[model samples]
Target: MPFIDLRAQYAALKPSIDARIQRVLDHGQYIMGPEVQELEQALAAYVGTQHCITVASGTEALLIALMTLDLQPGDEVITTPFTFAATAEVIVLLGGVPVFVDIEPDTLNIDPTQIEAAITPRTRAIMPVSLYGQVADMDAINAIAARHGGLPVIEDAAQSFGASYGGTAGTPRESGSAPRGKSCGLSTWGATSFFPSKPLGCYGDGGALFTNDAALAQAAREIRVHGQSQRYTHTRVGVGGRMDTLQCAIVLGKLERFDWEVAQRLAIGERYQRLIGDLPLQRLAVREDRDCVWAQFTVQVDHREAVIESLKQAGIPTAVHYPKPLHRQPAYEARSRAATPLPNAEAAARRVMSLPMSADLSEAQQDQVVAALRVALT
Candidate 1:
């Protein structure tokens, strides 16, 4: 009944994980070691991007990506209000205004339709978060960005690294598919987290930035190490954002069965949808063109607090993906402005609850959860 079941994943990949860690330890190059480059290359190839820059954390990934974009003070970045704080946190930290946009009711993703209206002359970028491991409508979003003089689109893909977009249903198109675009490869800049609970995670905090622009890639590389063009030549202002070598090695180990894990997550999420179909709740909508790896298998329920208490009594663990929208939060409300009414984001915050989910989630475990939920609702 572990919420994310990381222990099970570790048990499954122990041998490879142990070996990878051992290799890192033996080399004694903890900071920006060979494994770091190896992981960057592997992830770049997997994501089908020209460059992949690893950073200390998902926040660092977003921060570095924004830095590379030259986000100036008072610049605005339009993004959904429904995502984790990091989506907007980076923008605020960089002295950029985060213009809050509403999310789609069903998908809980940033509504592409609302984006254009939010774009003012100060708007510098569009940051669309791929919430709940499903990518937002990148095609439509990209088209909008193009219409507005090609505003850089930075996909905050923290929960969607292994997910695919624009693919035919039931296809194994992780990469090497012309028609399908991987989550991190779909935009100008895609930043993803390797936080332990993500679809693709490492042992500790880690994240990466992916982009096709070589100049931007070079800029990010320099920024991650205090803006070092060479050893001591400081090119520009930057942060200590490098993802250590050991974390990179752990991610490489996790990548060994990442494909299979993605498949399992998809299947498990579908089964959850089906099992909950008759329940008094709203299932998250997955678009026909894309898949959610179910970073968290979330659903909307009435009287969420009661349901949570009941499930807790039943020994079933559940969590709220978010309890409040960013615009309503204390830290962000005064700082960020809502470009559109965030009705969906607010409603979702009150209703959405995540059940225990992982690639390692068992059928029996899933059944137990559903049964408990059913009783809770009744």
Candidate 2:
């Protein structure tokens, strides 16, 4: 089966997507068009944030967020070592230091307990990635940040845009009373990707930054457009980070079905966990208070290479979220301030494997993957 069934998704939303694209074409405002503002409004409303600033890419969203914070050289941003390279890359790119922290074995998110010890006078922000569609412990992280002079907490929510954190509010049940919902909205800043494969993806690269702070939102808006507070007025240093109009249209189209897609992802993830329970591998834990959107539906396995090979032979495709810890990466090795050993991150990098997952993934396809995995382990 295809790694991620974007084709199926497109087929389902063809009419709306076509109309949205056609409208953009008619307007001919390719750059920073009306759709961009419309999308920003929709996203801000969806996430319960006061403002949403669309950016060129998820990486840009993170970078712009940091720029708005006015991070300076030698300033530190504490983050997990187990996330995508872009999570920490933005920090180092701006001449800021990335302080590495380990992850929780179950959620594979940055461990909040380890964050305070890593904090220093130069620490400017705490960036925690919501890996594999599950949010990190933001309440505790926020508490820690509050204790430390209200340090900015940026949720690297590239994977967990739709996923909810029950701890902050409560959990939403299928039929029962809604558990309070909190995830991306639970931080000082939330950054999410609209890369085509994400749960809330657009047709191409697009992303957004969400925050309630009016000043930070204004700063991010400026940063997205070469730091121009007004036409040709450069207020601060910035990047060409504005999301294209066509991309914004695509995201708007995708948003129409996003709620259903999120439900499908949650259901499919639960099914995968249930069906694979009899297998020899270890499934990712979905905490009682939170759910994973299954951005990767990852599982821990021994001999991951062998398992992947077996699945590939059976016509199933799989991928890895990350293969190396940031501290071990050549680019960050010299720049990172990793005081403690990232044993969990390192072990997870070697063992974690993501299976083919999408709202469109079928039960038969899932069964085939499981059977192949069983034989591979044997």
Candidate 3:
């Protein structure tokens, strides 16, 4: 089975996708077209934020967000060591230091309790990753930030676009509704990816930054366009990070059915968890107040290499969300400083594995995967 069913998704959304792409073609404004502003407004409202700035890729979104904060040399940004390289890469690129912290064993998100101790005078921001589609503890993280004279908090929401936190259960707002607690609306800056495999993906690379700050929003807008405050007016140094018009149009089309897709993902993920419960593995822990879109339905299993080989032999596809912690990697090991011994991060990196997951994944396919995993464990 396909690990991520983008083909099936495209088949379902063909009509709207085609129409939007055709409109972009007709307008012939591939760079910063009307659809660009249209998507920005729609996503900002959907995220319950004052501004949403689209960028060329998820990495670019993180870079632009850091740029807006004016990250300087030797500045430290506290973040978990268990996330994708891009989370720390942007910090190192700007001549800043990334202080690595451990993750919660169950949630695999940054431990908020460990954040305050990591704070030093050079600490400029706290970037917590919402790994595998569940949001980190933003309320507690924000509280910690406030205690430290309000250090900026950036949510690395690249894997969690449709997720929500701290809202009453059973009361899901409509797709366009700007309910508080949405993933991209919960922090100082929320940066997410629209890479084809994400919950709300476009056809190609795209990402967005969400924030309630008006001045920061303006700053990001300028940064994405080579720091031009106006035409040919270079106010500050920036990068060419704007998302193209066609990609924005595609995302707009996908927005039409995003709510339904998110619902399917949640249900499928829960079903996967239920089916895997009786087996010999650990399922990811989702908290009571929040929801996961299951960007990848991940589980932790022993002897992962054997399990992967067995599953591969059975014609089932699997992946590791991450195989090693960032601090363990050569490039980052020398660059990042560990706040404490990341025992949880080390253990998780050794055992975590992901199964085939997508909104289009069927019950039968899920069952097949579970059955294969059962045999693999044996």
Candidate 4:
């Protein structure tokens, strides 16, 4: 069985995807066509945001969001060290510092309790990553940000596009409540990816930004197009960050079944958890109010290498979400600002393993994975 069953998804949506692609082909305005705007509109509506600016990639989406905020040479962006490099890469790329914070042991997300201490006069923003398809602690993070002059909170929703955070860490807020709300529409800026394996992925690289602020949305729109206010008019320094029309078309097709896919992902994740309850390994924590889309159905286990090998021999695929904390990476070692040791992040790095997951993942496949894992652990 494949790790992520994209072929199954493609087979399910082949007709719509083919027709969408054909329409784009006939138009031949591949650069910035009508489909782009259509996708932007569709995504904006889906995410309950006023604006959705499609970008070339998830990294670009993060980079553009920071650029729109006008990050400066000594500015610091508070973020978790337990995420993909791109979460911190964008900060360092623009000459800003990445202030590393520890993650919660249960959710593997940034610890909101440690955030305020990390904030300083040079801090420009708070970037919280929604890891493993579940949103981080946004309520406490946002409250801290608001206390400190309303620092721009950027939700790195790359893994959590469809997930909602109804404040289980605290009281259960309404669907769109302040500070504790949906993932992409929760904070000052929401950036997500479509890396062909995400819950709502397209065929190739694509991503979008979400915001309710019109001025910031306008700034991001300009920044994506080389900071141009008009055609060939360079107003500010920027990058070529527009998502191609073809990719937009693919995303449009994928959006048709996105709601159903999210439901399947949640159901499959629950089923996996229930099936694995009797096993010795520790399952990932899905909060009471929020759901994980299970971009990767991850669990913590001991003797990880041996278990992985055994699973491999059983014809079951497994992968790690991330194996190293950003602070330990050679490129980021000099830049990380870890006030306290990241024991949880480091522990999670060594133990967490992701099983084969997708909306199309079958019960038999899930049982195979669990049985293989049981044998591997034993």
Q: Tens digit of lDDT per residue, candidate 1, span 1-378?
A: 799999999999999999999998998999999999999999999989999999999999999999999999899999998988998899999999999989999999999999999999999999999999999988888888989999999999999989988754444444543335789998899999999999989888999999999999999999999999999999989899999999999999999999999999999999999999999999999988789999999999999999999999999999998999999889998889999888999999999999999999999999999999999999
Q: What is the C-alpha local distance difference test score of each model?
A: 0.93, 0.88, 0.92, 0.90
lDDT per residue for candidate 3 within 85-107, as digits (tens), equals 99999999999999998999999
- Model 3 residue 242 distance off true place after TM-score fit, in angstroms: 0.4
Over the stretch 283-303, how does candidate 4's per-residue lDDT look in tens digits? 888777677888888999989
**Per-residue lDDT for 127-228 in model 2, tens only?**
999999988877688889989999999999999888887644244434432224545677889999999998888878999999889999999999899999
How many clashes (backbone N, Cα, C below 3 Å) per candidate? Answer: 0, 2, 0, 0
Report the lDDT of model 2 for residue 59.
Answer: 94
lDDT of 3: 0.92
| Model 3 regions more than 4 Å off | 170-180
User: Looking at model 2, which ten-residue stretch has the lowest summed lDDT?
Assistant: 171-180
Q: Candidate 3 at 263: error in angstroms? A: 0.4
